[model samples]
Target: SAVISQKPSRDICQRGTSLTIQCQVDSQVTMMFWYRQQPGQSLTLIATANQGSEATYESGFVIDKFPISRPNLTFSTLTVSNMSPEDSSIYLCSVHGQDQETQYFGPGTRLLVL
Candidate 1:
């Protein structure tokens, strides 16, 4: 099992700015992922953060827009750059559990860009 926590549970940002959301896991995890949940929509994977390596972004998502950092097994940060009203959503951090299949997610950071 893995417990995940995220910072800035909710925030209101201005357009053209950025926000960084932190993720911390209770234990080391092999895989960590960042996702975005738009209003009334399912989660969309932003990227896969790999420790000691550059993060792998998903299709239509770029590193410049959603940069990720995995400093170690249990810590990571995802930055949403150049914010816009369309970017308003709930950003989530998740980690693969000890079972390596099940994933645990942080509460999420809700951002509203105006």
Candidate 2:
């Protein structure tokens, strides 16, 4: 089983600000996924953080908007840069199941951009 934890459980930020969310996995994983949930929308993959390489972002996100860091197989960080009201969402950390390909999620960090 895999367990992931995230910091700054929730926060409210002003527009144009930035917040860095940290995630730590109890076990090493080849890929750690970052996701976003906006309002009532379903979770969207922001990027895939592979150890020792730059993160692979999803089509809608750019590096400037969401920069991810994967220092090792068990740790990663995601920065929500130059925030705006539209950036207000629940950011989550996830890891692929070791036994199966299914993804397991963290509780998520809730951000409110005003």
Candidate 3:
């Protein structure tokens, strides 16, 4: 079993602002996934965090918009570079499950960019 933790459970930010969310895991994982869940939409994978290498981002995401950092095996961070009301969503950090390879998510950082 793998356990993950996220900081800033919820935050309300002003427009044109940005926030950085952190994720920490109890064990080393091969790949850590970051997701953004907008209201009423399915989970969208933002990127895959690979240790010692650059993060692999999804099609709609760009490095300048969402910069990811995985400095070590057990830790990583995601920064939302720009702010907008549209950026308001639930940002989650997850790890692959040990047995089934299913991804397990964090409690989520609820962001509201006003």
Task: Judging by lDDT, tell me the better candidate of 1 and 2.
Answer: 2
TM-score list, all predictions: 0.97, 0.97, 0.95
Ranking by lDDT: 2, 1, 3
In model 3, which runs have C-alpha deviations exceeding 4 angstroms?
none
Candidate 3 lDDT tens digits, 25-84: 999887899999999998999999999999999999999999999999899999997789
For residues 1-114, what per-residue lDDT tens digits would candidate 2 score against the true structure? Answer: 798899989999999989999999999899999999999999999999999889998899999999999999899999999999999899999999977589999999999999
Candidate 3 global CA lDDT score: 0.92
- Clashes per model (N, Cα, C within 3 A): 0, 0, 0
Model 1: CA > 4 A from native: none
RMSD, one per candidate, in order: 0.7, 0.8, 1.0
The Cα local distance difference test for each model comes to 0.92, 0.94, 0.92
Top candidate (lDDT): 2
Superposed Cα deviation of residue 106, candidate 3 (Å): 0.9
Error of 3 at 78 (Å): 0.6
Candidate 3, after superposition: displacement of residue 112 in Å?
A: 0.3
